[model samples]
Target: MRNIRFLVVIYLICQNTLFAQNNPFYNQWEPSPKEGAFQMEDYIVWGGSVIKGEDGLYYMFASRWPKHLGMSAWVTNSEIVLAVADKPEGPFSFKKVVLPARGKQYWDGMMTHNPNIHYHDGKYILFYIGLNYEFDQPEKVGATRELYEEAWNHKRIGVAVADSPFGPWKRMDAPILQPRPGKWDGAIISNPAPVIHEDGSVLLIYKSAPVPYPARNQNRTMNFGVATASHYWGPYERKGEDNQIKLLPISSDVEDPYIWYDGSKYHMLAKCMNEAITGESGAGFLASSEDGLVWKTSENPIAYSRNITFSNGEKVNLPKLERPQVLIQNGQPSHVYFACRNPEGQIFNMVRPLRRNQ
Candidate 1:
């Protein structure tokens, strides 16, 4: 009996070691340009997405803000910008500011952030969050608190459409999806991860909450919800109306979710708010569901961790890695992108290529 138990322990250890050796191609991001290739002069660039356009160049949609605005400026003054690179691992050149503030009347006119670019139905669709402040204060650093709160209280999901990635984008007059009055997502909807299906349908997985909404994320909790539309310019309807928000229950509050349906199942890589639920603070959760509404996290749901081992043999456990996005090139997940600050005090996006067997 003792020998049998020893053999069982040995078998488990060997299996674990073998699994650890099989790192995917995109797991280790290239640390060649230590400062990262996406930084701007007076702006701190974040929230990156890379897409191959008809021009054969990779167009990246990302968020940026003034350097003096501090890290917290993302909420109040962030704007979406476009950059072009010859390759996905880009020495990218700035193209233009894709989405900027219009005015106070439009729902997303005050600020434009969190750009998720996709080519859908023979057009380029840019989905994002916009906020407006009707308050009596100027929107600066400290004085912008009331404005920030109003923006937070009024944030909604808006979309822009264009023929080319380098667009003269035609933005819709109103948000496609808005907060429901008495539903779980009544407060706000942000952080949109949308997948346009081969059948021409759209599936958007976004973060939301109810009306007793707190301004800060760490002070409150968020859940992932699904909405479907036959057309990108839709009539999007939430999957389970009352139970729309709380898919995983309060025991496992998730955020920063990037979801895709890979034909057979829905796959998600989201941040687990509680360390006990997913191993570490920034340890990502790998979950799946056959139907989009029902989800199940993996038995050992550690997708990746903050402690990254770069391709060039540099390894550092950063403070945290936020915003997980996958660049699908040639019909497969070719690279992974995330927002992280380097040791050089520059916050920019990072990428790691995903290969079959590294």
Candidate 2:
């Protein structure tokens, strides 16, 4: 009996060692902006998403505002632009604006922001937010102020399509998801990122605010939720409520969700107001789920900024780092690209390569 017990103890020790090696967040922290990469531009560039296409280049979709306007301009006056790089770690060159301000005759007729892009079924779909202002008089600029006040009460998540990564894209005539009247997502539905399953179903993860509450000028809470569709273009339904759309259980005041699978389990990285393990802003938290619907978060943040500025001379360690997009090489996360805000608290597009081995 004593000999048998000794063998069991040895086997258990080996099993625990193997398990520890597989957890990606086992290490405390890792270095970013790997050697020899150009730092990001100092200007405000938020809402970044990256894609490596068959053309053998990296394409990034980001929200940009002029330097003179400051960060708040994104709420009133910002446009989505595309940037291209020969490699994931830039020197990236500005391409062109993807979504211009709406013309006339649409709800999102004024400002456009919060871009997330994903390729599905041989096409690229871009999701973003559109704010509409209803002017009392078309001729008077001052009257437009009251119009915006009423419209600013809500925002919608809109979708657009492109045949190629770099393209003259086509926008959907209407939004895929909108705010519900008295629910968790009633106030607003923005920041959309689509997840495509192997079985050909699509899941959309987005941020929302409560309705019948305070105005944009007032303080409000933003939460995340998921919606599903049998096809990429639907009539998509929420996970619960008899296809009536339901919200996810976890509540962390989190935004900008990026999801991925590692063959064994699904993982997510999101931006939160809560202090991370390092107790700093711009720190990202990691979570895992055996099934995609439920999630388990780590006690500490898995990723944080090291106070290294980008090439554009912008301070790297600001409180605002939203939109976490993962680069999967060989089926694992090799790098993460985020929307980094400047020292003054404006958003900018930046990329940080992860040390997977660590």
Candidate 3:
């Protein structure tokens, strides 16, 4: 009877391993050179979220501004827009600009960018970055790097709540995460990567840098930081401020972290900005943490690269790909979504796969 039971346990472990394949990464990828409705001849689109709606359609929450406004506009004049698609790899149609610059009096009056949408606490919560400041050059299409650098240093993470994916988001009076006065993130904090658990705990991994020395924009000591809260929206406190959660070495940094908690641990995918994972710039890497505070790079840390090939056997090397997000469907990673750049206009999506063969 003991030997029979032992054989059954061994068989069960083998069966489960076969089903999961012992690999959670790798998948098919497709790209639309120019994306969705808002890709006007004069508009620039950047970071976003693509989620399946309860209505059986796909909704993308993204950031955009005019090409005439110049790239720097992302830090000064960008807003969160909504678009819909029938399929995950879409010719997504622009629906509306959901979060716009309210007014100078508001903290997010200048720009609202980096939208990460999640459903928790019986509502849809929009995690994003907000920048606010006073400026007089309305007629000018763009600002100088010095001007943008000043505005960007004030960026903070904010959240908006809505009953449904479609509408009526209520934002707070101020940002939820602010830069600590004398820490690594003392100058700026943005690019929110949030994972909301069933028990209502929220884990947010975001980007940050220390105070500037010679000038604000010249410093490039950007790295990842961790914060957690009992509720989806917080009162979030930074976890490793004193030691700093430096996943990579002090010489290298990671950004655009998308975190998810499997049953046993926390996992993340982020842009390997400094050749830390793949020994190349503009690559994607995967990592995990048992406790959601300290992280370890996967043995095969390089997940994908900016240069990608499709399942159709066609390939093209992209100049840039950033802001990686995984859409979880039915307790598994379904689709990999991210932003790509083109000369004609910016693409709000790269349209990738998450399965081994796609």
Candidate 4:
């Protein structure tokens, strides 16, 4: 019996090694460019989603808020903005603010963030998280926790439709998805990652919480769910058991997910909130789902680490690297975009090219 157990252990190790070797996304990262980053002198940038337009240009919808307002103010002051680049690996220049604070009266009036752009059925769909609160906007870095908590609970997934990327966008009066009052997603819905199908259906994944803000501080956890809509803009219905996609049986601590359907199967890459499955905090993990509802971790699950390599061969583990977005060209992933913060508090959007012909 002891020998049999030892054989089982050896089989498991061999399986892991074989899977790692066969994983397409593993070791596919090429050293990134040193200069072509999207940044602003007075703002903190995050969550960049790029799409190639019919005009033969790349358009990026990203989130940014004033630097003086502090990082926590992202819940209150962030806005969705547009940038343009000639190439996917971009030195993208800021074009304009696409979604800004209008008023607290509107559902998404206060702030817009985490833009995920898609082009489908002759229209451009911009998916994001927005929030509103009754209080006045905070001025400086140190704001009250109450103010932050209130803003956090207000987050909801929203979308804006436009004929062209250049826009006269028609934003909805109500959000596309909202929190369930007593359900697992009772607190809020944020960080939308959507894949618009060729048949005009949409499979969206978003971050959710069980309890409202401040209450969840004692046990901070997040859950991810998949919702489907027949049309791009629609009454989306949650799928799976209890409307939650439990990626890991042990922990539901993943966040900032980016999902895509690459012809055959659905793929997801998300930030590992804890070292539960990936064994490294802040690493990106890959998961696969035959259908959008049921998902399992990819064989070599560690998609990326915080450590980044430059074309010049310098490697640095970023202090903060979150919000993974992929730019797919001709049904192939060409580059991956990330929101990174260095130790000096400098925040920017970085793009790393993916090795092709895999």
Candidate 1 vs candidate 3, lDDT winner: 3
Query: What order do candidates take by TM-score, descending?
Result: 4, 3, 1, 2
Models ranked on lDDT: 4, 3, 1, 2
Q: What is the lDDT of residue 342 in candidate 3?
A: 52
Compared with the true structure, what per-residue lDDT tens digits does model 1 show for residues 4-26?
A: 99999999988765643322221
What is every candidate's alpha-carbon RMSD to the true fold?
Answer: 4.1, 5.5, 5.3, 4.7
List lDDT for all candidates, in order: 0.73, 0.64, 0.74, 0.85
- TM-score per candidate, chains pooled: 0.85, 0.78, 0.86, 0.91
lDDT by residue (1-358, candidate 3, tens digit) is 9999999999998965553433355333443323332354556777668778778888888888877777777888788988888877666778888898898888888889989988875688899999887774243674666677667877989999898776788988888777876777878878888888898888888888887433544767777888888987688887874635656422366788888877888778788777767777988877777877777774556667777665555566777788887877776666667777654445545567555342
Angstrom error at residue 298, model 4? 3.0
TM-score of 4: 0.91
lDDT of 3 at 27: 30
**Clash count, predicted structure 4:** 0
Taking all chains together, the TM-score of candidate 3 against the true structure is 0.86
Model 4: runs farther than 4 Å from truth? 1-22, 248-251
Error of 2 at 265 (Å): 3.4
Error of 3 at 195 (Å): 1.2
Among the numbered candidates, top TM-score falls to: 4
Better of 1 and 2 by TM-score: 1
